[model samples]
Target: RHQGFFRLDPHVDPISDGGNVFILGFCSPTVMSLTPVGGAMGSLMNQRAVSTKSWAAKEDIDVLMEPRTLCHLHGDARQLLNHGIRMGVDAAQLKKQGVNVPDNASLYDWWGGMTSPVQRSPMRLSVVLAFADVDEIF
Candidate 1:
């Protein structure tokens, strides 16, 4: 599984001034399902409360983060979206939830659509490289 975090803002964090920031995420080959569990601490426009939200909550994009795929986030996307790979869903649990599981597909495959039960790969290993613009490093 893969997860990304964005912690900035000068008032909250002394190490950051919340300036220009970017994140480069590198996914390994073992990644099969890239489920986004979004819940960032921020207030949306017209929204009264600061609730957990994410871009995936609004979009229905099916593009999985395949092996060797590079994910880039900057500015608004970096600060707003909170992405993470979801835990494996058990077969029985899916059925109990009234989810339709295909005969030939496993619970993970039914949700992720990348791998089958037997063909399921290992946990994903990812590396995050962060960059911040600054005049001096003190």
Candidate 2:
């Protein structure tokens, strides 16, 4: 599974920001499914699996730095914070632009289609959405 996050306006209440963040992540891959079809009426029945890594609060992410399962960091807190926040924002923006979807079908059918692909591809299992406002499990 792929993981990601976003940095919201701290001014937004924590719960509301967190909820929107979660929706933003959940709605992301849904929007991706809207892709391949150009938002038409097809489905991603042909694709494979879809999985996402969990969301982590800024503090939690900081703690993960000790082991650093994710590579490519320069070991700077401000940089990491900036990167994570931007990732969340970019995930949101990507949804707006249309990317990372299996097909252009309804959410249920799209999910159903993803659950059962015509030709299984390990690549599909790697697909995931990320955002900062997102909460754990989103």
Error of 1 at 74 (Å): 0.7
Q: Over the full model, what C-alpha lDDT does candidate 1 score relative to the true structure?
A: 0.34
Model 2 residue 40 CA deviation (Å) reads: 39
lDDT of each: 0.34, 0.23
Name the weakest run of 10 consecutive residues (lDDT summed) in model 2: 33-42
True-vs-predicted CA distance for residue 65, candidate 1, Å? 1.2
RMSD of each: 9.2, 16.8
- Among residues 3 or more apart in sequence or in different chains, the pairs in candidate 1 whose N, CA or C atoms overlap within 3 Å are 1-124
lDDT of 1 by residue, 51-121 (tens): 11212344412234455666654454445434333333445545555665554333242223322221123
Cα lDDT for residue 53, candidate 2: 15
